[model samples]
Target: MTDRHELILTCPKGLEGLLLEEARQLGLEDAREQTAAIRGFGALEVAYRLCLWSRLANRVLLVISRFPTTTAETLYEGVRSVDWAEHLEPGGSLAVEFSGRGSGIDNTHFGALKVKDGIVDRLRTASGERPTVDKLNPDLRVHLRLDKGEAVLSLDLSGHSLHQRGYRLQQGAAPLKENLAAAVLIRAGWPRIAAEGGALTDPMCGVGTFLIEGAMIAADIAPNLKRERWGFSAWLGHVPALWHRLHDEAEARAAAGLARPPLWIRGYEADPRLIQPGRNNIERAGLGSWIRIYQGDVATFEPRPDQNQKGLVICNPPYGERLGDEASLLYLYQNLGERLRQACLGWEAGIFTAAPDLGKRMGIRSHKQYAFWNGALPCKLLLIKVELDQFVTDNRTAPPQPNAAPAPVEVARLSEGGQMFANRLQKNLRLLGKWARREGIECYRLYDADMPEYAVAVDLYRDWVHVQEYAPPRSIDPDKAQARLLDALAAIPQALGVPRKKVVVKRRERQSGTRQYERQAAQGQFLEVIEGGVKLLVNLTDYLDTGLFLDHRPLRLRIQREAAGKRFLNLFCYTATATVHAAKGGARSTTSVDLSRTYLDWARRNLSLNGFSDRQRLEQADVMEWLAADRGEYDLIFIDPPTFSNSKRMEGVFDVQRDHAALLDLAMARLAAGGTLYFSNNFRKFELDLSIAERYAVEEISAATLDEDFRRNPKIHRAWRLQAR
Candidate 1:
C-alpha cells in the first residue's frame, strides 16, 4: 500500500473541469482541476491510466508537492526541501522547466538552474550521487512555475508537453497542440457530433490536430496510447499488472473500434506551407490512410462529395493580429461566409475567431459559441447553423428594424461575457466624451487605429479619408456591416471634396508580401496633418487601416509625456506608435509585442522618423505566453488586446470583451512599482471589472486615454491606468 502515490494532472486552461469530469466518469476519486493543472490522489494505476486515457491534457505532471515560494532563493530552498531521494536516481539525468514567471524573475534560465541545482544537491547530499541535467531526455523531469510570487513544482511525468499526444511527427510554423484541439472540439460539443458518425473537418488545419483528435474520438482511440513510454513507467516498484491492465484495455478499445474510412474527415488550408506537416501529422496519428487533407483556399473548399454523412466544419481563420490587411481579408471572409452557406449544407459550421466582426461575415445565426484563448487574443468558436437562410428567415427575423434600440434581446447569457452590453456601453460613452475631438473629416473612423481594432485613416488636407472596420463583431451581421461601411464611405467622397472617382475605397486584404503592402499603400499618395497637429497621412485610407487611431490619440499623448525616462512595455503593440510617443517623450527603452512582421516594420518607420527607432524592441510572440514569460519592468505598459481572437494554431483563444480583468491583471503585474499600466479595449461597451483591480491601484482613465478624433463616439475606448504601489 505504500506504493500507492498521490499525483496531480493538469489540462490546458478551460478544460480542467472537463478533464475532472472525465476522471469522475472513469470512477477516479479526488480527480479535479487545480489551477491550470489537474489534481488527483490515486494509486500509481490512476496516474498511469490517465497518461493513457486523457484526451485534453498538455502533459501529466505528478505533483511532488505544491508550496509557496517567493524569491529565487526561496524557490531553491523549497525545491531542495522536497524529498528528491524518493524518486530520482543519484546518478540519473534529470531536467527542470520553469514557466509562468510573469515579470517576477528576470532570467528563466537562472531560475530553472537554481531549482535544478536544488534537486541535485538534495540527491547528492543523501545518496552521495548527483544527476546530470538533460533538458531534452531527462530520466526524471521537474516543472517549476513561478507565477505572481508563488511557485508550483511538479514532476514531469509526461516527458513532453501532453499535447504532444505522441502524434504530429512534423512541426508547422504554428501548429495547434493536439490536446488543445481536442478541448476545442469537446468544448464545441464534439462528442455529441461524433456519436452520429458526423464528419468533422478543419479548413485551416495546419497540422491536423483537430482532425486527428476528432478521429480519435470517433475510433475511441485513447490520445495517449501512442506514447510508447510514460514517466511513471520508470517508477521504482511499479506494479506491472495494473499498468498493463490499463494499457491493454485502452489499446484493445482502440484496435477493436472500426475506423470507417477517414473519408468522413478532411482538412484544407490555402497556404501550402502546412501541407507537408499536415501529411506528417496525419501519419503520426496513425491515420494517414484514414484522414484526408487538401492544400487550397477555404473559399473554394467543397465538403467531401462521397460521404453523405454531413459533418461539422471547424476552422480557425486568420485574424488581423497576425494576418493584417483587413479590407482584403474581407474577401476571404465574405467568401468563407458564402462557402458556409453554400458548401456546408446540412452540416454544422464551427468558426473560431478572436474577431467577432469577422464572425458576422459568416451570415449564420450561430447555434453556439465557445469562449477560448488563441494565445493572448480573445476569441470565440461560433457553431453556426449551416442552413442559414432558412434559420435566419424562419427563426430570427431582422429584428423588425435593424438598428431599433435593441429591445429586450435576451441572449441566453453564458456566464462569460460578464456585463450587460447596453449598460457597459452607456458607461463607456460617458467616460470617453471629453476625448473625442473632431478633426474635419467626411467620416468618423470608428475602429481605425484603435486598440484591438486596427482600421486606419488617411488625410488630404482638412478633409480626411475614413475606412470602416468591424472588429469581429458578434452581434452585427456581416452583410449589413458591409452595407453600413459602404454608406459611411459613400458619404466620405462628398464630405472630403474628393470625387467618388478619386475616393478609392480599398477594403483591406491580407498583404501577400512586404512588397505588396508597401506598393499598394503607396498608390494614393498625399500628405496632411490637419487636427491637433497630427501629421503624416498619405492620401487617407487606401489598402489597410489608415495611419492612426483617432481614439487612442489622448492615450498616446499621455505616453508622450509620461514616457520621459521610464522603460516602456507595449503588449500587442502594433505600428509602434505608442513606443514612438514614449521614446519622443524621452523613454529609456521600448519593447513592442506583435506577431505580424509587417506592422513591426511600419512601427520601425514610425519610430525612425521620430528619432526613437533605435530604442524600440520587438518580440514576435503569442501575447498571453509572452506576457506570462516577461519579467522585465516597464514604467509605461500598454496593452490593447483584440475583442475576440484565437490563433488555434497557438493553443489558446482570447476574448478581450470577456477576458479583460484577467488580461489586465497579468499586464498590470508586469508594471513596476509606481509604474503606469495603460490598458485599452475597443470592445465598444467595455466595462472594466473593478473587482480584479484588487492587486493594484486601479483607476478609470478613459477620458485620458481617449484621443481627439474619437470625440464623436465616446465608447471607442475603455481605458484604465493601474499602478503597483
Candidate 2:
C-alpha cells in the first residue's frame, strides 16, 4: 500500500469550500475544492480521521484509479485495471455506485452493472471466486464517476453516508440531513459560539437534529464515534489497529469533554408528538445530559439557561411545500422574530429558510447571509445579532418618551381617497353585515371595485379579510393604480376591525395555462367559514382564488337544497366545495372530479371535514376525459369549468365558448332520466349554445344564482338549468 493516497470528499452543493477547509484542518495535504466535492492527498490514518471527524461530507472516496473512457468497453477496462485483490476479497459482497452520465454511459444502473461485471470478472480470473452484489451492507462499496469522458473510480471509505451518525431513526417531515445540519451550524458560527461556552437553542426543533449536532460540536465529540459500520469495515486493506487507535482517542476526548460542565443546549418543538422522539434521538446520541427537549410553541419559546447566559437561537422553520402555507408561515416567522427580541435580546440567531422573502418579513436585519442548497432547493442562513439595532421598527413612529404618560395607540391614518374607500367599505358592511347575519353567511364579498379608483375586491371570511387588487387596464397609469391600492390596503384593517395580519392581499391578473392554479403564496392558512350551515375549509392566501368561490355561494346553497335523495356529480370541482354542500344536503352519493391533485387532496379534506367521506368519491382526471368514460348516471350535475384551460394533463386546450356545446352534450349523456344538469361559467361573454335548447328544456337562471353580495356584479357568472326533452 502506498503511504499517500488520493482522497475525494463529497458534500452537498455549496459546502465544498467549508469541506475543503475542514479537510485541511484535519491534516489532509494538497486539499482543493471542486463542485460538491473536495480532493486531497492524505495518509491512511488521515483518511480514517477524516471519516471519523468530517461533519459536512457525504462520503469519503479514496480514489483508486482515474482513466479516460469514451465507450462501454473503455469503462470496463478502466474498472478492470484496478487490482481487485488489494481492495476486496474474492468471495466478499460488494456494492457499486455510479454517478454522472457520458461516454456512452447514459444510465447510472447500466454504468454500475458494467463496473460490477468488470470487478467480478477480474476477481474470478485471479482467485476463481467473485464477489456477490449486496446493496445493503456490503463488505466493499465502490464508486465510479463518469465526467467529461473520464471515469474516476474510488473505494467508498464511509458507508451508509457519514451523515447517518447511527442516532436518528425517526425524523420529522423534511428533516435536514445531519451533515447539512452540521454545515448550517458551522456556517452560523456554532463552533465559535460553543468554544466560547455559549449556549444554543433551536426553537422549531423537529426530532432535534440541530440540538444533537450542536451538542456534538460543543462537546468535542466526533460525529461518527457511535457508528459501528463503515465502507472499510470488511475491506482487505482495513487497518483495524489504526482505526481502533483513532476511535479510542475520540472516545477519550468525548469523555473528557463530558466530564467538564456541559453547555446549556436545548430544543423546543411545537409538535407534542415529536418531544419523546427528539429526546430518544438525544439519548441515542449520548447527549441527553447536555441536551434537553421540550414541547413548546415558537410563539412562546424562551431559552432559560443558568446564570442568564446568552447564546445562539437557531431554527430551521418550515419552508412550506404546499400553497397557502406561507400565509400561516408568515405569522410563524413573525412570532419567531418577536420571541427572539423579547427573550434572547443579547443572543445571536441563525435562521435557515428556503423562502428568504419570509425571512425579510421577520422585522429583523441579518448581519450576514450565507447561501446553501438544502438538497435541490436553494436556501439562506441568516445570521443576526439580537441587538436593539437589529430590530426593525416603523420609521414613522416616534420613540417612546422616558417617564412620560403612555401614548395612545396610533391607528393608520388614511389619505383622502383612502378615507373615501374606507367609508364605502364601512357603508357596505352596515348593509351587508345585517344581511349576512340574517342569512347566516359568514363568508361574503364586502366590496367589489365599488370605487373605480380602488379597483379591488374585498371579501370577508368571518373575521378575516381577503383583498384582491384587480390589475388596472393598460390605459390607467400604473403609479396611480399602485398608490390607490396602497390606500385601500391601509384602510381595510381599520374599516373592517381586523388586525393587519389577518388581512391577506393578492393582485388579480389574467393568468395563462395552469398559472391560475399555481400557488400565489405558501401560507397554507385555511379559514373555516359557515355557509348554508355546512362547515367548509377555505384557504384565503394560497391560490389565486380562495377555496370557496364567494360569488357561487347561492349556487352551492341551491345545490344543497335540491340535492336530497339524488346522486350528485360536480365537475371541475376545485376543492369540491359544491360536493360538500351536496353531501350535506343529504345526497345519497357524490363524486367530484378535477385534474389537480392539490385540489383533489383538498376536496378529500373538505369531505372528511364535513363527515361526508362515505360514498364520496374524488377522482383525479381530466374532466373532459373522465366524462367520456364515466358510465354512472347522476341525477343532479353541476359543472363550473374554466373559461380557457390548456393544462398539460388534458389532451388539448379547452375553450368554453367553442367547446361548451360538445361539453354539454357529453355531460347530458351522464344525466339520468329526469335528471337536471346545472351548467355555469364565470366567462363574462359566455353564451349558451342554441342547439342545447332545441334538444332539451333550458332555462337561464343567471339572475337566481347571484347572491346579495354579487348582486352588483350579476355578470360575475351565468347559470343555466337544462333537462333532456
Best by lDDT: 2
Q: Candidate 1 at residue 225, lDDT?
A: 83
TM-score of candidate 1 on Cα atoms, chains taken together:
0.54
Among all candidates shown, the one with the greatest TM-score = 2
> For residues 1-725, what per-residue lDDT tens digits would candidate 2 score against the true structure?
89799999999999998999999999899989999999999999999999999998999999999999999999999899888999888899999999999999899999999999999988884437678999999999999999899899999999888998989988998999999999999988999999998999999999999999999989999999999999999989989999999999999999999889999998998899899889999999998899989888987787957546988888899976643343456667767876877788889999999877667657688999999999999999999999988886443332222233334333434568977998899889889988988898888999999888989899998878887878889999976775677667666655666655788877778877778787877768788777887888988777888888888888898999999999999999999999999999999999999999999999998888877879998899998889999999999999999988998788889899999999899999999999999999988888788888998999999999998899988899999999999
Collision pairs in model 2: 324-523, 324-524, 324-542, 325-522, 325-523, 325-524, 326-522, 326-523, 327-523
Model 1, backbone clash pairs (residues 3+ apart or across chains), number: 51
lDDT of 1 by residue, 1-725 (tens): 35455666776666677778776665467666676666667666677777777877667666666677767777788889988767777888887788867434678898888888898888884537678987778778888877666777877677776677766777666566677678778877778888876778887788777888888888888888877766655554356788788889988888766445443788898878788888887887778766888998776788766546677888777765322244445445555765766677778777777666656644457767777665555778787777735342112111221123333321111111212222332233233322333333322342333323223333223333344343445665766555445334323332223323334445444323222234344445544343333233333533455555556766876788788889999887766667777777888999999866756766766666655657689887778878788888777898876666654435567777677777777787777878888778776666777686776778887776644445545776688778885
Off by over 4 Å in 2: 68-78, 101-107, 125-127, 147-150, 395-442, 447-458, 466-681, 688-714, 718-725
What RMSD, rounded to one decimal, does every model reach? 19.2, 8.6
Please, what is the whole-model Cα lDDT of each candidate in the order they appear?
Answer: 0.65, 0.87
